[model samples]
Target chain A: MTGTASRPTLEAVAARAGVSRATASRVVNGGDGVREPLVERVRRAVEELGYVPNQAARSLVTRRHDAVAVVIAEPETRVFADPFFALQLRGISKELTAHDSQLVLLLTEGRDDHVRVGRYLAGGHVDGALVFSLHLDDPLPGLIHGAGVPTVFGGRPGWGDGPRDAVPTVYVDCDNRGGARDAVRHLVGLGRTRIAHITGPLDQTSAADRLDGFRDVMVDVDPALIAEGDFTPAGGERAMRELLERRPDVDAVFAANDLSAAGALRVLRERGRRVPDDVAVIGFDDMLPVAEQTDPPLTTVRQDIEEIGRLMARLLLRRLDRAADEGPVGAPSSVVLPTTLVRRASA
Target chain B: MTGTASRPTLEAVAARAGVSRATASRVVNGGDGVREPLVERVRRAVEELGYVPNQAARSLVTRRHDAVAVVIAEPETRVFADPFFALQLRGISKELTAHDSQLVLLLTEGRDDHVRVGRYLAGGHVDGALVFSLHLDDPLPGLIHGAGVPTVFGGRPGWGDGPRDAVPTVYVDCDNRGGARDAVRHLVGLGRTRIAHITGPLDQTSAADRLDGFRDVMVDVDPALIAEGDFTPAGGERAMRELLERRPDVDAVFAANDLSAAGALRVLRERGRRVPDDVAVIGFDDMLPVAEQTDPPLTTVRQDIEEIGRLMARLLLRRLDRAADEGPVGAPSSVVLPTTLVRRASA
Candidate 1:
């Protein structure tokens, strides 16, 4: 009470309310069994003194920071390149808000950030983590596992044959392979034979899964029909150009995502190929606005991105609760939500 | 040491290292002024026991959370619509990470979140807050200000005739009015007399400022020459259509931002109008990929959005340091960074 003249301490509030420090503490921390009159007096005293409870101190006894960290391994530009992460973040935020937990967002751009993130998680600053480890060779999954924090991954991580692989990971991901299969089948239903594919960066599991789906359908297709893209409009444009040059007779194209699809559409327009008439096109991840705003719109695979985010948070929160209620029980199983093909003007 | 059987306490580490609890505490909490051999022994013991420091306990004595909350007033979708906020976040992350501060991101989508954010900020969970109160009528500014936590804003808030206006708010904003002026003046230099302006939602200060900038150059033009937008591509398309119907002779358009500009371009293209010959277009906030991806590319007013974020962090950290050294000095003044015109094929 006497430490900082301008700031009121718990002692001051207790003295003003004519109660013991213990009674004041109970009253301030929710007043479970405190008498109503005493609680009211303490509340009034707190209001008059403008007392703010120190969260860190309360968290020490409760062993709950009430905060969850969402670790995005990509740089900010990549995170914002499309609306995928944004929608996911919103879903995660909504759920965390419902649970009365704060979201500690960690965006790791490079190797240095990896060390920082690993250290932060191991330091026990947050209760649990929702990590987006998109890349197959990403070191984050291994580092995070080593940190020994309860975590739920955003996408299905590529678990290599290491000691880390033995640790079961709870993750929330869309059915990328199935979605790609649905897209390719739709193009096949359109009576298009010479179909080409533009894939997102192979390092990412989503892109790799999509590629596998494409191959599952086009088992004997020419290898020249495939082009590598980085899930950006620029990459889409380059890939589209290469595909057109390699097989000018190609009647349809399947792009990994909407941004690249938009770029491919632009190339088709430049080359005077009518959409769905001369060259039908389909894309994955209907990252709206881009999917909707592209000239003639886009026919693509749609994943409930927000739901994935929410599920990730729910899984992590459940794990945290399980850990708290009965030490650590068996980990929750991972989730794989379905994806549906959205028909539009393009395909 | 004996509270939780599985979790190792600081006492366990001290006992394992054969040192006094005080000596072990000194070593574990940085090893300042501790003997090198003793520090090594304590570190080895900590590693062997997997002892993680109790952050809450340490924070109670140090009075530092080593964390900052980034309060984004917008919902996740809008934040992700363009890369504007993403770049700003990256800039902030870069600076905060450099200073060893964790980022606690709080995304407020509705009214309930306002209360949650206010409570979290006032609870002394984090050292400070960087808030983005984009809308003029937003209640967030008032609630956050009432919390009495140190805060810095992302844009100029619409502070009406309230007692809140008396409190000087520190913020970081690009020169919206000035950037708009440059955009319109660029059109004027191109000899376009029938130039129309697409205003962003007037509820936002950035949009309002840009409209003022248009008026600053256009002077007394037809009121029909201006169209309202919500900074989305759909909004832009709607506004562009409205403008084309209102003034068919319009030869140029200056959209408040790039998404809107892209929409306007789409509309113009659909109407079979040749760009730059029949109509030229310009946009603000060259939000990278969008500005670059637009057909004919876009001439734009470029503001260092990332730098704005970095500068905001720098200002808040400076204030925090000043407050720590002496009681609060004069508040740091708000900053308005200059914007420059970027010429592309569109204009």
Candidate 2:
């Protein structure tokens, strides 16, 4: 073994082992090549010389930073306030940590920021990219793919035209339609025919799917009672107020998210509507703390955000590993995790 | 100016400017040195060559990654559920983006993970670190300091002791005590003599400080009415139930946070108590959605979470720059932002 006097360089190891610098580097980096006896001799020489490969130098040779960038297409304020983003981030971080890769998080607020993000991703700054909360017609997918990097999306793009090109992408999504259907079914089971719907932003896939599910369920009952909310509490409150003004006899409401549901509940109370007595309510995406805190609680759809995040990370890693040697990597796959209805007093 | 067709190399620029490779590199990287006329010539050559120095090569020479790691010391599930964490992360991301530096996100689950984090920080993987949600007596601060890397904590460590070392840290905290006092005073003004307090985890600085403020305010009124919760909805529900069982005459409660306050409201509703008219309720941390969701709404203390996060990032950035200039950096510093009382329907 080498003494503590001075550490030897890769050149010293190569000279001692009577090998070329390239051969020594390949052996040191665990790259394929060279015979067993020569490899053994190089290994011994490396141990004796105590040569530790510089990380920066190794990174240059490998062209792999072992880092993935997570791009959030929203304002910083909205991204932080939303529990879904945080939970998914946590899951991504945990899974990435296990794989010994790094996570680079970026938030794009405006068009200029989007351009900067496009340039950064295309500039070989990270090995792969994960885009979250994408809108329907967002040009990011095209831009990121044009950069010639592997990409994965958190949720299915609202456009839902399927993967456009040979650009590999894995979509991790919750069962939005199934969950919304279950929520509406529960309302129907309660014998509430005049059920009003408070929908999220129509441009979002989750919102559209949830609204469609609600309508599908309502066609069997009545489709005349529907309104829209932007998934914000204030928006829900306004929607609830509008529905009440339009149809004062509405007996139930299905909100696309817990925040909107909670808002609807608040407005209902102000109008002297008793939860589950005068008007039953159910929400989608059972967010923590707030869901539990809702007076009379809330019957909602539960999406496993952490699990979704973990799955997204795994899919990205698989794509990065070039596992699909027979074909292309990550062949535009879609993964829809199951969601269940959480029953509470509200419904 | 260099045309698109005639992009010059560093070698070409050096030859044209009649300077050495080292001199040209130093000039291009904005490093100190070189005579004025030669520097001007090199600049002209650079403009003429359109030679954009590669990031990898520049990072190797400068040993600066221009990246900061935001370490969240919570499990993935909790990280997503807590709006406070989300807001803080968003704020940090925004500031880092504006600075044109990348943000790396890391979460440590256990003791072993902490060691890995230490190596990651010490190996010059990042320029500095911003840590959040530190539990009382957590050894992470010491671990970070021992690694010889700079760290900025989100809050005062609340371990009842001072920082282990004089490591330069920047903290952005809310005026928890002042906000709590104002909340309790509002209850008192509403002619509620028997006011009970539901506090957050006593080990947290905000919890302890808010409780202290409540006690200080109650000294002029009565000190016998106090209860503690773990800053969770369930904890708040249990605490509220216990308070009611012990003292049914209690007419007012000041919870440490909006979630806990919402929990208390639920329990009160179950117990057939009317909010505001029967028992006025107040909560800290206005947490917009939660506050608006409560029955009769909720009067709360508003601490701008987004602003807090932004301020924390700015402060940490300053500390990072300072630490880089100096040697191992200095000890923990604190910055407290103001809080406002928001009146709603509850109290």
Candidate 3:
């Protein structure tokens, strides 16, 4: 390594390597699509010259910072403790660490923070972003799209049918519809007719897809059997109480997530309704801590959240790696991981 | 305003503003000291020229990245879901957003990851760092110090008396000792003489200080009354079980954190020990979900974790802002926030 005062420049390295500046820049960025011999020559030249690419200067040339911004845009503080993001973050961290990339975590406060996020992305602060935009009217999608940074969303984004809709983006998500279908199918198999559903915030695609899945299975079902929850224990409790008030004979319940199911379970216990006896209950997102620790233990749909995080990172990295080559990189398609039924004491 | 292709350079802006390039740079990089009129002129020239100082190029001159690396070196996944880091991150995010800076999060896995972290920092990717070095044997402090990046630690780092021990670094910590004292005092006020303690992992300073605080209150205490936990629910369960087996007549318990207290409460309930009636319980960190949702609400020591995060960001930002002027930003002093006792039903 050369001393900072006399650090070698990319031009000098390129000259020494007997290569064009463009080729050297490509090699430094990632060496994708470059011939192995030329890549090695450039690499040796860089080492020999002791050239350290200044992050800012490097960005100016290659437009790559080797950093991905993880934008967690949740308005509700209760969800912060839900362990979903934690598992996903761990997965993302491991994958990014392996790639020698940095994670710039941006926890947005509200609508105002969305503007800040958009500006930061547009300003080229990071190479790509992994965003968790859970709401339909979030406005972040359009903003992020306008910024033109390659992004892989954590969950499927909700887009309106308006003319000014956001461009389709790549995302990694669990099969929420299929997961809900399995949960409801399990309840149906238990010979429960008056099945009630507790949905997470419908503004999110996951909740909306789950609701759709429920509707698909229970065609001609009574609307009163559904109650909205914000995916928190307290919300689940409120929704369960509302459902109980509306349908006294409800024999099965499918809460969107384990946290909501935990809340619903507490309510059922308080009302003296025996789980799986009076009403078989199933929850989605078999979050281990909540699913395992609930009083009777919850029978739920389990999604590999950490795997989703890893896949998101992998997709973004691949896209970024391809961008270094002298060709148009095709837009990446979304990835949807399968969910499994986790049977426990609740059902 | 200038467009991206023809974005103005700092030198051009300096000429337009009739100031030296250094003065123009100072203005661009958070203009800390230069007179008001010159600052205004430089800013106007920047606006007129549509100047966006290349982040890496700016760093080359100012030696400031306008970014801070937040190093969280916890190997456990449970702590990630504890909402402690979430609250602290929110605080740090708000402060950094206000200052127009970026937060590059570094989550270390093990020894190999530590080497990667050291290399990245030494490579000068960020202006400074906010490290949470929980373990006593963490080799990060020495490696980070060697990297020459100005660092402000989140918790007091534990160091052994070796020849290469790191210099006393700036840190922000809650008064763990004082909080523990308050917890013990609350138990003592309830006339609990046969009080037992569940200590957090002793590798962390918070755990050690809290244990020290317990000793300060309970002189000549029975060694068998204390059991060690890793600040996890499972760890708490194991420790509580061990404590109960040792001191069958224990009338009170002080868990180092709310999660541990929740675990201890579970054990007490399973063992048919009525909380606050048979055995009063107190916990630290006052994490709302755990503290408030326990069978009986937990009495806890409340430290403002978010405030600690905000203060850490503010201190590091202040140091970076001062580093612009050619002067020794003398050693920064540490900050210790006070904790309060929240008396809930369990106590």
Candidate 4:
């Protein structure tokens, strides 16, 4: 036990218990069919010998590794920078652990790795997959479906119609539209009419929904102020600069994400504008670092990313367990978790 | 293909390939010594019939999944909030992908998941594991090694001598001592005589080494100016406030990590102290958001977390391949990557 000596195997336990290897494995793995007397004998042997069943051997019988793949479509740098991914990862890790599953993180940004990921999933290396950060018309969803494996996308895939090809998918989306609208409404409530918008990449559904929410509210008020950004601080800075050059008197801004808002804050500072007093800045996706560390701590929309991860894992696990017996376990359901407006110093 | 369809088994592929099931499995898995003509026939049959071999079946023959687990010991909030984890994850993901290995992320903070993780690794669920954030006397490194698994720790495991067990570990650390010394020396060169040190958690090797480095430099300058923090923003703020109360004449501060430095900055600002002009601040482990978003930005020591991850993965892969030929790999080895002083508005 203290040195590099290998632990006793199932065969040794079986030999000690005077039972067959199959009976020993059955008792160790807690299979239901073993007799009560044999179970006790095997259990005592396992305790005495301190035998841990080889996981590889068990996986061979079960044909299930009890692992799930979490695929992200962003560069490693951006993924780490965004607190949203971490929160979701934590949530997923927690839920997966409850189900005795492991989370395999797959970054599919590079073209070569992306193809390899498709083949890996298709090859049945994982029990299921939970994909995040899907771009519109992304090939992964279809590729996964074509491979006959169960998958649940984090956000709604670009496929407009419900579950394409009968591939069961569970989309856990934040109330991007409502959250963005609420953010803009808060600005309007503050009596700022010349409000501009800094949006994320238009290709992403989150970006589109948020931008649409901003436009929907703005059209009812005034549609003259609109600027697009790529959901980055630099993008926000450039967008804010453009918005200012277009309308110097713009009194408020709604950035689709926190980094962009931080960028807008930088641009505002450079232009000698006071936050909240001169320009009320609001960002979505209440990312932790930017939300708290912003000059005037950013007032933003808080999306419960951890909850999203938990829900996605639960849904995928359900599908993995009952896909054969009960067909798809849940409805091709879309769960939109609520987003609340966290009013901080900036807004 | 449209509805839920059971995946084709090896038996199905064997029937389709006009060969025995064992022969088909060997051909599909690229087993050596197979005749070329039959191999060509098997390959064509696999492609034509859209047959994908289950990884479990393939693993039985090849005993390789080409996957490794990278375990982080922090909670989800901390994992995401700290840019260091993200950078390292990205680096490991990139390197593993290059080696055609999958990266599995295992978070061991949740106590309930501990058993599942232990079983997963011990069961040969992964080829090897790379673990991060080990406190002194932490049981995980020993437990993993005890299970006859190959593992690597992200940083020094706080047991000053090195890993106590014969587990072959590759530790990727930053120049904590040099970075801390340089930060203190920079403050000294700035003509700030009364410099106070804010240290990170004493248990972590980085924190301990940094504290040692700071003390060494301070002894050369003045050993009287020293305090301790937990590498957290609140901790830094508390430490800074205590230092201020203890010595109001303290002109400069050196924080062990960036979060604590950010905390220090907040406290200094609340007390109406101007950065650099009044009390200059320096931080280590230059995490992106905190450093960038802090007012006037932060001057800190930059550790390449991505490189650390990449190196760790490469080392683990090498260890895994080497162990395949030899018995278990030998004692743990450490790799200390270089860190640079990033000058910004803080110091």
Best by TM-score: 4
Task: For model 1, state the Cα shift of residue B45 in Å.
Answer: 16
User: Ranking by DockQ, best first?
Assistant: 4, 1, 3, 2
lDDT of each: 0.81, 0.75, 0.79, 0.77
Candidate 1 per-residue C-alpha lDDT over A1-347 given as tens digits, one digit per residue, 9 for 90 to 100: 11122445789989999999999999877669899999999977866665656665667687777878888877755776657788898899889988978777766555445645655665556788898846775556545654567888887877732224345667889999999999999999999999999999999888999999999899999999999998889999999999999999999999999989999999999999999899999998888778999887999999988899999999989888888888867778888999999999999
For TM-score, candidate 2 versus 3, the one ahead is: 3
What DockQ does predicted model 2 obtain? 0.09
- Rank order (by lDDT, best first): 1, 3, 4, 2
- lDDT for residue B337 in candidate 4, whole number 0-100: 86
Instruction: State the fnat of candidate 1 relative to the true structure.
Output: 0.16
lDDT of 4 at A84: 74
Which pairs clash in the backbone of model 4? Answer: A55-B123
Q: Candidate 2: TM-score?
A: 0.63
Each predicted model: what fraction of the native A–B Cα contacts (within 8 Å) does it retain? 0.16, 0.10, 0.09, 0.27
Question: Candidate 2: which stretches are off by over 4 Å?
Answer: A1-68, A80-104, A115-127, A135-150, A155-308, A320-347, B1-54, B61-63, B107-120, B123-125, B159-163, B181-194, B217-225, B274-278, B323-333, B340-347
Model no. 1, DockQ: 0.16
Residue A45 in candidate 1 has what lDDT?
A: 81
Judged by whole-model lDDT over C-alpha atoms, candidate 1 comes out at: 0.81
Residue pair clashes in candidate 3: A56-B56
- State the fnat of model 3: 0.09
